[model samples]
Target: MNTLKRTLALVATLAMTATAFASCGDEKKESTPKEEPTTTATPEDTTAPEETTAEPDNGDEIDASVKTGGDTFTIAAWNHDDVPYLIAQWKGLSFDTVVEDLADNKVDGIKFIDMNVGGGQAAEKYDQLFNEGSDLDVYFCEADWALKYINDDSKTLALSKLGLGDSKFTNIYNYTDEIGKDQNGVRKGISWQAAAGGFAYRADLAEEYLGVKSPDEMDAKIGNWENFVAAAKEVSEKSSGGVALADTLGGLWQAFACGRTQPWVVDNKLVIDDFCKNFADTAKELWDCGGVTKNSQWTDEWTAAGVSGNCMGYFVSTWGFGGFFLDAAGGENGAQYGKWAVCQGPTPFYWGGTWIVVNPETDNGEEARDFIISATSDEAQMSAYAKAKPEYVNNSQVMDDLIAGDTVFNPTVSGNFKDGQNYFKKLAENAKSIDFKGLITPYDSTIKGNFADAVKENYLDGNKSWDETVEAFKDKVAESVPDLEWDD
Candidate 1:
């Protein structure tokens, strides 16, 4: 709470630094939209919220002001990835309900506005919606640009307004809780998934190159940046430079950046500490020694590197295993299938997460509250969703129970790993360890992405000096965010 208080106090000074930015710069793999589902089934009856009174988790009944039974409830998101499935789970639809069936933009009384845009572009679409006074009751927010709405009272509704309070969200992860709150420490949003990350590696490669047969051994081998570099060197030498210990510079930055102990900006000035230089130097070492592959992420070559045995590991989040990680193994029974495993990387980090925010002008506040509760608060629904969508749900208690129960979120993805490892268990450890409390800034997405780009282009790829790299990073930040005071 002290961190949140401190963060809120700094908002007045730092607010201007992000108000000019239009898009989320945090890079993420988005879900591909599908046309329709192959099978059609009737959506199950949904449970409606109680009409007059609501009891919060702390055993206090509050007078609910939000009215229910609106003619239509509208929800919006950039893509069809999450909202569809979330709706399915909330409605008690069959766990096997095909998401594509809801992609037609209609499911019962709910009218989904599929902006069909990238996460970065969703803000523009939402702006248009708000300007037109479109009927939007609930909307999703990416962690990066979430503050753009959370901080705007006119855009986001406080959960307390709907009779939901802290007690209802007591079981969620800490890092995610911080991101959903706005300046002054009011909860405006909540997420359903925890996008924690870890280093996923080829089990055979670790054993062959580093003499590490288990994830525990591999984790110890690269426990810190220093040890990680040493292990990379060992892998490079043993493999005759044919295989790299890591995947990409971008991947390395994702893990390393989270270790930052300071905000990107303070007092309207950009803060470029030793963390930046250290990352550049580390990335350069990997680039020069072939410790990491040159292939860019989200590309065919990136996935092909794994199949051809050119790359040993990838820094992956919970959502990735179901998507790109499968491709890296060349699909089920493919070349690299069943040879993979995951370990806690050099540091604890989270990649991408989506939050549910209510529109302040919404008429279906009760429905919004109920939907959020099902996705984020209610243990049973969250647990069902965790396994059904193969998601790493945001509720820590639910995830802990699932992990203890040895629940397999996805079979094909687990089967692709060595010994069919339950990868979510590793991510849960990371989810609990991530602490981005007072450290979050609205400009974080842009600054982090810009910093990563400068490091890759100037230092690692261009062979520029460290000072030159710093200058390049500064120049990029200046262009992206001109409001900050540059320390020359």
Candidate 2:
């Protein structure tokens, strides 16, 4: 077959195969760590003024929004931050617009249904819309659960359907491409940011405790797991139990899960590799060593620890730095604003990310294509995005500019987490280390959770023996996923 025919044939096959997810009507919700947006920082930081966004003159004008008979291009998510990205990118404005405009469908000449559901409740709503054969235009999928939807051709439309080609995705991280590709290798989605993680530590804490003077010096104190533990011991002993090493158990869990080399399941049977066991042992070790604070994840206490200068640092992805870490440090105006720095912690693992997905049958195809391309592909918009925040944006070209050592840091983020240093240089290097080839599974969310539960039961609490804990975990997994095959 000729190239066009071959491409068309592939698109048709992929669309049919991937639709299995929502055929009975459901889109995938996040099974991965949820991204905390830069909006979470504070009242002032979240709403930077409109006059600040200076559009780059890179000369790539995206095609106009879909001109329909007043049809609103509906996009849904569980949060309130994503829609503003679209509107701002479209209007080429600074990070100043009110998200309420999209929420209430008040933007002129264009209509939008920026429906946001509460956390953990988006899946059911997506299913309801799909079941009712709604005209949903664009949506998002997270790293952990994206496969559930992307592997279903019948439920999703390939970006090719809107004239997008692989060329548009050339600069995105390879792992991102691996995750967003359909089973047949057709690209189905694109993530505008790369969620590479690092160690966000208090420069003051590192210096006061370990005498580590810079991010590089601090990295040596805990660059690997062994060093990390040794450093935690040092932190505990030196602080006289005044400071805890762990911000929370979940932070370590995020780092460990993504660095796995094997699948959680192999041929329908569960496989708890050495790394997972080590993760369990290590989590408990951190807890016992008084290496962690007692505050729960996302609690005000946990977040406040960073600003109050209590917890040492966190293991988080790129978004974590700009999102939670940025919030915890307080915005530029807060006390600990410029005191935080990032380095590679224990292992290089990615955490959360947002990928844009589409509805093939919607009438808003042009708008969808334009938005995706502008947000992800157009260099001009990406440059603007990088200039607005220190996210490890998916585009390498922009990242190079960001790393140029002084020019690309966003002025709006006056807190300047890295103190004008391109910390992403380390992140960009670390991004290359991730390989998700055999690591992911459809049941990742449940299996990962159960394993953590088992660890908490056996190691953390001692309520169950190791073997008993594992078996109970297996039992729970079996119940949640009836088809999960055992190793025997």
Candidate 3:
């Protein structure tokens, strides 16, 4: 059978079972406010105008040794490599040329300083830095830590005051109402880039054994959670004991759970909506089908699985395609180069991203804002950095270059670089703006650790019933947010 025919068969089987057996146990009991479905099929406009190739500006005239008013602009970031990209684009030019063009259009003497902080020590180090009155001008915060930084007020700059609260970087700020904006319409940080989630599977394996071709067809067969697991079961049966995918039940559970809800906690009562139950049951089914690895035993399994070609691709964040997945596959694994591709998962869910914020206490506030404007402008600097690094563009227009360029691979849809970009666009459309107030408390580590442990024990081990697990989750939420009130 051809890939198309097999996929059609799988879809037919799933559609038949969906009405009777696939209803999610925890879907919203109260009808979720209807919004036009965002992920429906749309016609492709593949022909876009080419981007202008302006001459590169390497900072030359301004003396590198000259100090402007004893002002040193310090930027705190987890990725230290971005500093080089900034310097390469704008180093010695006059404040007008560098700051105005690159930074937000200010002309002031400011010495650039970049700090490298590891991701593991993010919150602790940031807190210490803020408390000690470090002369930091800019900082990057992850999704979970964004609320902590914004709520503290004194630790960071109020972007509204700095004039960056209304940036025009459509992709980064495009979904502000949903992801980046606070309850009071305060824009604390701008999403600099994103790592979208999609299914990466072996095209050759699917073609030869399973018979799958186009992503649209794949969507029919394995689009949502119910169909995805059913397809995995069929793949497992066909492979005869070989792992269908390279993920553990915990990892799969997290992806599905996160995808199903607005956020993990809403109004403080651990959201036990039908989606949650559906996600848990999906994990249970995968576990029963021998489709998952244990959390403790995936390292060697992942390594061997990648090299052996027996396993199908696993769920991957967009950034992981370049950073983690490519690195693990040894960067251009000969014949495996074009064999892998991406497809939309059951639902749109974001995995990872970083937001950049300016510090209000800085003496060079104007200069800092200028720098931010230039760095984040829809111009080439931001686009180039995204291209060179394993980073996704926060600017929608930067995607033009990405789609036109040959370097970035689109594993979901073969021969279509726009595949990932389209996926993110849809995700942004469907996403509900989650309130981050109680999700990341001051004691972030403790909260995350406890939640991770509970998820592993209850879902992975199958030790607790759904009701019991939800009750435990509620207790954990109460421990974190003592004053939280649910609408009940």
Q: Which candidate's TM-score is highest? A: 1
Off by over 4 Å in 3: 1-70, 90-117, 165-167, 171-179, 266-268, 295-300, 328-330, 334-337, 404-452, 478-488
- Model 3 deviation from native, Cα RMSD in Å: 14.6
| Predicted candidate 1 versus true structure: per-residue lDDT over 58-90, tens digit per residue | 233323555556779999999988888898898
| After superposition, candidate 2 runs with Cα above 4 Å error | 1-72, 91-95, 104-109, 330-335, 389-391, 408-420
Q: 1-488, model 3: which lDDT tens digit per residue?
A: 12222112121010100000011112332123322221111122222222223212222222222223425666676654454345434443532244333345242444343335555457667777778887777777765445556554566544555545443444453433233434344565666565455666666666655577755666566766667777878878888867565455534643453433233333332334564555567667777786664533236666346556656666666556654455334455433555565666565444556667766566666555556666665467676665544356566566555655644434433222223334333322222221223233233333333444555578657568876665555455444443333322
Per-model TM-score, in order, reads 0.86, 0.80, 0.70
lDDT of 2: 0.64
Ranking by lDDT: 1, 2, 3
Which whole-number lDDT from 0 to 100 does residue 486 have in model 1?
Answer: 36
Please give, for residues 150-194, the per-residue lDDT of candidate 2 as tens digits: 767656666666667766777887777777767556677788888
Rank order by TM-score, top first?
Answer: 1, 2, 3
Question: Per-residue lDDT for 461 in model 3?
Answer: 77
